[model samples]
Target: MTAAVDVRARLVDRLEASGVLTPGWRQAFLDVGRHEFLPDVFWASTGDGYERCDRARSPERWLELAYSDVAIVTQWDDGTSSGQQREPTSSVSMPTMVASMLRDLDVHEGHKVWEGGTGPGWNAGLLARRQGAHNVVTVELDAVVAAQAAANFRALDIAPTAVVGDAAHGYLPGAPYDRGILTCSVRHVPPALIGQIRRHGVLVLPFAPLFGGGAVARLTVTGTTVTGTTATGPFTGSSAFMRMRQQRYQAPPVDDYLPGDWPGDAVREYTTLNPLNVVDDWLASFVVGLAVPDLYYRRSNNGGSGMTTLWLFDTGVTSWATVDFVDGASRFEVRQSGSRRMWSEVEDTVRWWTAAGRPGFERFGLTLEGGEHRAWLHQPANPLPSPRGQD
Candidate 1:
């Protein structure tokens, strides 16, 4: 066997030993050489650092990344491949995440699975190997990626039905799927998916809040309703699944909508809190907003007299806040003009969450009826009473 094949075998052995790979999955891993599914030029993450994989120029590096468990970012900011200048738009999810999602899916023999965001078709190949190629139907929004994935599957001799379309609608041609797994992160559960699932079918996906922070949720559909809880332990790794076309770009500038000066106190504070941390503590931000909606703030850093700006996009009609820090205190200046009172809304959301015993996102639930989606905090039977100041 070639060294590449040997490395693939070793990777499979590690997965099996880690208790993540079932016998069937192990066979699938061994059968499907990952190099066949990856691009000639891709990103490779090693323990030491990230390097480029060029099959034509650096075949050795390509083979190394293909056999490893790390995800290779395939598309950045749409489908342009100009080498790392654009933001990451899509990727083949890491092997551990794929395994965890598969375990959560719990696909059975002869079961039909509808997969979303077909990056390179490796996961689909695994499902096909376990449940038969005819049982797997995968969808991809980008025709280019879909075509590439089809080619990869062809190279592996697995002909799963790969469709080029919006996965947000769920591939309805193969409706009533016994299992539905989305390799991408979704801000909202599309109603179409609920309709496409067979009664009592399983749906495994990574759900992200509108403000941010994501968790893998395993839900069971009953009739047309779906219910589930968040998985314990953080799979904290990030995936670069393409954002829904409608939500792909950041909102337009907030300056167009903000008033020049209508704020009571524009308070800004500086700390080590990063964007990820802000997303995780969305409730805290919301609470602060409810108490002080009129307050505006911005983040800035000075490097030898040059200023860098950090803007909050979703907080109402504001585009960016002016941030200043001195003597361990921070202040923010809101620069938007709108009747909505973005700060107030945030505070209200925070207060709403806090009064309910500060229930974590696990207590939050979603119910989809037709095209409408309603989010609730706490269980139906023991719902927290609505706050009096709620709008």
Candidate 2:
């Protein structure tokens, strides 16, 4: 226990030095140590895939993982699989990310905070300590995970109202909260959460679009709308959090997209744009995703030859395009099909991005009004032209 405490102190100091752990959260972090909430058997994807670790079998190793900056997976396949398959469904996020989100939360005394996901209850425990347990309400989707978190909270001698249900819907009974935060990322901000926060109340969450790449955002509620910018200050960083249960993607049948005669009837064309340019950078993925919301992509290469194919698919199943790149060639060939000109859209988005000097995530923002969302640049008034517009 003494060793654990020393390790915790070391971690706090490390994160504080990184500027993510501010003075406001120092004591709360110390008071609500992570080891107490984490389960005895958890998974850590230290390398390629999820690997299980048992505290009883190797206390020293478990302690090292608990105190380290990496995220610790507590639940696998949402509690459906065991021993064989090891895909993480729930976890305690990295300490630095937790601290960064908390700092952006900017909670004050007497404020009520609604937490979206209660994985292991460590974050909720920190919140409870910072703002009396009664002031924190946490919601989790899985009943078993929620029960375990409840038990963990009791063991730690902190009590926060823990609900077992969909966090995307949020906790309505405890409405009119002063602040709200989500451990999980969302493609769309739920209307219930926007309605629950009082005017001027802040809501901090990770916003992940359907395509790829994501970042945390801090929005303020006003009237029937909420508007804010993606987090950009020093401590802020990128995220790949699990999607809200309701927002999880259910990809269409592979056969439907790619018939036995794949690329059949696709209109082939050529352009000077290099396919490698957009796929290599997260910022490029984000910008292209904003411009083309309904599209997702896959890339593959031909053996040994410096040639690759970029396959694009529409979430709506209405369009598909494949861009092929060959070595030492300034131009590329694109085969596109369906009602939407998917390749043309990609080309236009890339063109616009280059014209704008290739802006970063901080230059982007979102505004939600009555459940409708619109992505914009610099400010809400300067909205980005929707993909729905003709190429």
Candidate 3:
């Protein structure tokens, strides 16, 4: 136990020396003993001496990882308990990522803050410790995680209000917060979160676009509007956060979606890139999603040939379309007998990105209206006058 405490101290010391830890943040890191919140066994991906979790052989090792400046996987696949599987569905984020996000949030003392996605209450605890406990409120989508987080906070004697519900809607009961932080990665900025912030308040979250990719975006809210830019640094890492409940998932059959028989000269292939790298390039995909909202991609390998298949789910009706890009040009087809021109949407979005000089996400800003779930994108030179104009 003493060795574990020493190791934790060393990790905190390193973080502080790295200049990423502010004075208040350093104190918070020291105060919050992560071992108390984690289970007896947990995986460590740091590539340090320890890699796998073993409660019997090394209880001390597990406890050490819990306290170190690293994240612990707590859940896998919706409600699957950590003890059941190795596939991580949810985790307490890494200390550096957590600290970086808090720094981006820039929450000062005594400010009313609303936090979305309370994993293990570590971040909530940090907010309550910095701001008054009475001034912080956190929301979690899973009841079990919420209950565990509540207990974690209670153990520390920090009484921040922790609610179990979909954070996509934002906790409106505690309205007009000074700052809002979303720890989860979202395909789109939730309109409710924007509405929940007071004018001039700060909102920080990871925002990605459909089709693929995302980034940490920081926005400032003002009377029914928000404007902000993306942060640049090492990628914070990828998270499999549950999509907003409203963003339903549906996939059409492969036959209907595929283009006519492959061209004689077509050659299929595949490649892998870090998922974080994909999110960093979200601008390319956002342009694609806006133009082609129903796009989905699948990767496959058949020994000799490998390719990624693209499908378009038509929102206008029950039908969808398919496109295959083997050698270069895309071959299009339709499936499920529907009325919407899903193919047109995908092509149009691609054309828009091409015509816009392929501007990156840095050129775009997002604005959210308070008390409502609507978000708008703004360009420095050509601000989107209205959300209706996004199409």
What lDDT does the true structure give each of the candidates?
0.63, 0.83, 0.62
For residues 78-149, write the lDDT of model 1, one tens digit per residue: 777555545666677777778767877888888999998888888898888888899999999888889889
Ranking according to lDDT, highest score first: 2, 1, 3
Q: What TM-score does model 1 achieve against the real structure?
A: 0.76
Stretches of candidate 3 off by over 4 Å are 17-19, 45-52, 67-70, 81-87, 225-248, 252-294, 307-364, 369-391
Q: How many Å off is the CA of 15 in candidate 1?
A: 2.5
Q: By TM-score, who's the top model here?
A: 2
Q: Candidates sorted by TM-score, descending order? A: 2, 1, 3
TM-score of each: 0.76, 0.91, 0.72
Poorest lDDT segment (10 consecutive residues) of candidate 1: 228-237
Best by lDDT: 2
What TM-score does model 2 achieve against the real structure? 0.91
> Residue 371 CA error for candidate 2 (Å)?
1.5
- What CA root-mean-square deviation does each model show from the true structure? 5.7, 3.2, 6.6
